[model samples]
Target: MLVIGIGFFYLRPIIPFLQSQRAEATTVNKVKAIETLQNSDEFSKKLAAAALKRTAEDVEYDPGYYDIAYPGGDLPANKGVSTDLIVRSYRALGVDLQQLVHEDMSEHFRLYPQLWERKGPDRNIDHRRVPNLQRYFSRFGKVLNNSHSLDDYDIGDVVTWSLPYGAAEQAGSHIGIIVPGPGARSGEKWVVHNIGSGPKWEDKLFDYEIAGHFRFGPIRESMTAAADTKSGATLSN
Candidate 1:
């Protein structure tokens, strides 16, 4: 009877211990799965999309060139221009274009255009400029050929265009990020930009002459993966 009692006591503890171990194992697996998904390219696209959506929520459209601080500085969230869309989208992915562009411009100031006519790199406005971002991405990112084919660009890709303003043919640069999902127009991809109005997702991929096309970070790899997926499906079929 004593042996039976001891066995029962030990077995009861073992059952709870095994249950705890199984729960711990399940938790570890769940965490691992979450980490894997977070590291995927889809996560980056989702981050950019969320950023664009948030930007679109701000109805105020202020284009004033405010003198701001450096590094992590920013104007009022609601008050910004086209480049702010790019800055905030990439910022959502934890890729601070403001700091990245400022650092790059500081190292190679001469490489960037002198549109603002500033002597050196200004962190406050350098990243906020479309041309500076174009040059920065061209240098650091995979600069895709500016083509009319929509297949060339993918979600998370950055595109620039020239906007002529005023007389004397003074052209201004505009930038935007491509996002997935339904576009404003059927059979067209959506773009998040602040063109005069606040940030919005529109089917303006070819609205202006594409001055630059770039795949920054892991966007290119994601495009390749998507392409591979399509190819694999075709082969299987």
Candidate 2:
């Protein structure tokens, strides 16, 4: 009885530590299981690759309005907000979200949020707004359930979050793209976003209140073909 009591006393101190380690291992295993289940489709892979490339560029967190050209407009490469990351990524895939959003809003102006209170759609800045992008994705992309489960988010998925109440209106919302994690987080996923800083790939998937989740990838060949036909230029493969 004395020997057993001594052993229990020594083990009690490390019991919590062992439990935590076990829990962490379980989580990692779950992440790996979900990773294996990921579709790994060509479009998603391309989108993830494109977003990952953004991490290499030095972008300033600038949200100033500028009158860029239509059809394939973009803010200066060095300055952009979170939405710009999404814009640039999809643009890499030959998907002109600016044009698509502008055209859709033009015909269905009432369908979108009038938060900015503009008379009509402003192609110059509409696509750069988070709310506008959320609406666009919900309309055209597959809207996934917003949950705390890491399993729900997959590579190339787009996520949006509502910032805390005191944040500036322009900074009230944020967005990011999911991509494969780096190094130790390989079993998990990371988010690529430009929140106040330049583009980054970090393990911040659940850092904020998830407001929207979407899978908008695997661009249909017809869509790419139509874009090519309209622009009179072949999209990058």
Candidate 3:
């Protein structure tokens, strides 16, 4: 009885320490799991790099309607919106989101939101809308859980947020692509978006209500074929 009491008294102080160690281990395991599920594959790395490259461009925040070419269409390089940033990034990977979204909406018109009350798909402006892009990603890409936890996000992941009503020109919804955090925030992840000024890499991942999170890698077979064609080579069976 005396020995038991002595051991209990001596071990009491370290109990909290042991509990903290267990908690830390649990956190590490969770981080590992997130990393595994959202593993930074070659496609993701290239996409993230493409997104990072947008930070160097001088683009104006413009959402005006323009009749651009079909398939490989794009607005002027100097003008774009948030979705434009995403579109341009994917284009860098030889994936034309404008054409993909337009084609998908044409086939699955009912699957998209009718907020705009459009009679049919408008390829010119459909892919540039945040809701359309959200639906497209949900349908074709991997939709991830939305949470305030920073660990839930990773490079190349796409995040959508609900802005306050009448907040700014981008009042309804906003989207951004996750990129590696900048200098001081090196350990954290940042988002590349054009809120108003232009394409920017900022630490605003959890600034608003997270609506959707997505990870989209280009279709491998198509991307490979596109690359081979660009390099003046043909794929062999």
In candidate 1 the C-alpha lDDT for residue 78 amounts to: 60
Sort every candidate by TM-score, greatest first: 2, 3, 1
TM-score of each: 0.68, 0.75, 0.75
Candidate number with greatest lDDT: 2
Instruction: Give the poorly placed runs of model 3, Cα more than 4 Å off.
Output: 1-41, 168-170, 220-237
Tell me how candidate 1 scores on lDDT.
Answer: 0.64
Per-residue alpha-carbon lDDT of candidate 1 for residues 9-64, written as tens digits (9 for 90 to 100) = 87997887776554332334334433443455675465445444554356465555
Assess the local accuracy of residue 212 in candidate 1 as a C-alpha lDDT between 0 and 100: 96
Candidate 1: stretches off by over 4 Å = 1-40, 166-170, 183-187, 218-237
Instruction: Give residue 12's lDDT in candidate 1 (0 to 100).
Output: 94
Clashes of each: 0, 0, 0
lDDT digits (tens) for residues 29-95 of candidate 3 = 3334234424556777667777777777899888778777676677778888899999888887788
User: Tens digits of per-residue lDDT for model 2 on 37-108?
Assistant: 343556776677777777778998877777777777777678788998998888877888887889889999
Model 2: lDDT to the true structure: 0.77
Report how far residue 76 has shifted in candidate 3, in Å.
0.6
